[model samples]
Target: MKVKKQKRHRKSLTFYTACFGFRKPYKVLCDGTFVHHLVVNRITPADTALANILSATVKLYTTRCVLVELKRLGKSYSEAL
Candidate 1:
């Protein structure tokens, strides 16, 4: 199952690189929900986790609005902030 998933990811990434010209050290945008999911699931070292999935290094970014929303959610999500 994992091998199949990896192959699928590789094919998709190839398409992106060929058609969309995406480069390595992929940039990933996180929303409040995604951040909360990561925190709740204990997916620490987010860059590494993302890199493993993409089979390349990654740079994580989140919008100011996302941060504000996470903050608004208050203490339970403080670790995400």
Candidate 2:
């Protein structure tokens, strides 16, 4: 006797949309380079792009290491950050 195989059904787009009704929050780690680019020259295209990308659904965070490095780079810039 031959056994019959059953086909699996995939979830629909509406099912996924209903499952995720709200945008998920994201945590982003900020390093020395990101901070430097942000504070340097007041603003740049890269900074603007970063801002646009992180404006929604993201929270920025940094560690003591990054702060210490920024401090060592320059007092004014570090303070701005």
Candidate 3:
């Protein structure tokens, strides 16, 4: 008998942002994945847009959980930031 593994569902940051009611002068909670993209990937249009939006109207934050994950990702990844 074969048993299938179910995929875990995750909510998007936009969903949390809406739930938190962020409006003008927004505050964004950055996840490790977003940080990874920003650090490892070459600058793309999306990255530039994100940077511009953040610079213009948003404040970014991260949690201890994210820090822990980053640490787990190892020194090279952390140092890249």
Candidate 4:
């Protein structure tokens, strides 16, 4: 099942790279919720995890708004920031 999922993800990545010129060291945009999930689930070393999922090198990015949101959410979410 995991192999199948990986293959499917690879296929989708291929499509994006081919048609949209997405390249490796793929850039991943993360939101507050995503960061929270990572913290809550103890998904440490987020870049490595995302890279494995995308089957390529990855760079994670978050916007100022996301940072603010996480900050506003307070201490429980502070680790995510």
Candidate 5:
């Protein structure tokens, strides 16, 4: 039997839309150098609810799952960076 050698790349690329994203409620970022949970708290019928969804988008973070390492923020969620 013969064994094959594994290959590795020096760099890789990914898009934020590929991971977590939304057209409304929120946009989840999964960047290695810069990542954050972006959301807009919109008031619903009687209370606030996440209008847009981004569950699968967050899946982009494999070994470095950003969701698991998320920290509750105190700044304005609507702030544009």
Candidate 6:
């Protein structure tokens, strides 16, 4: 039973991830999503339109999203990864 539950959880993770981020060597996209639902006191960037676009197009992510964003902007977060 434990093994079956583990498998089901793993499968759910796979499906959830596929529905969320897109993967690349350098970065991933949030797509504004699940973790966002959990965040409090989050700030948009200085530019509202860019923030809006990101909010619109990006789905769900965690701090992992910030790591990917850093990488996309040619910043580093390998240690975080």
- CA RMSD for every model? 1.7, 13.6, 10.3, 1.7, 15.8, 14.0
Give the alpha carbon lDDT tens digit for every residue of 1-81 in model 5: 112211111011124335544233234334423333334423231111122222212222223343333333424321212
Model 3 lDDT per residue over 10-50, tens place: 13335645797645455557788877886677434443455
Model 6: CA > 4 A from native: 22-81
Q: Please write out the lDDT profile of model 4 over residues 33-63, one tens digit for every residue.
A: 8888988898877898887898789888888
Best by lDDT: 1
Q: Rank the candidates by TM-score, best first.
A: 1, 4, 3, 2, 6, 5
Q: What is the Cα-based TM-score of model 4?
A: 0.87
Model 4 has how many clashing residue pairs?
Answer: 0
TM-score of 6: 0.26
lDDT of each: 0.85, 0.57, 0.58, 0.84, 0.28, 0.40
Q: Would you list the clashing residue pairs of candidate 6? A: 30-59, 31-58, 31-59, 32-58, 32-59, 33-59, 33-60
Candidate 2, 30-80: lDDT as tens digits: 788877876765654443444454333445678998888988898865665
If both were scored by lDDT, which would come out higher, candidate 4 or candidate 5? Answer: 4
Q: Tens digits of per-residue lDDT for model 6 on 47-80?
A: 3422343332323333766656545644223222
Clash pairs, candidate 3, are none
Comparing 3 and 4 on lDDT, the stronger one:
4
Instruction: Report clash pairs, candidate 4.
Output: none
Candidate number with greatest TM-score: 1
lDDT of 2 at 81: 43
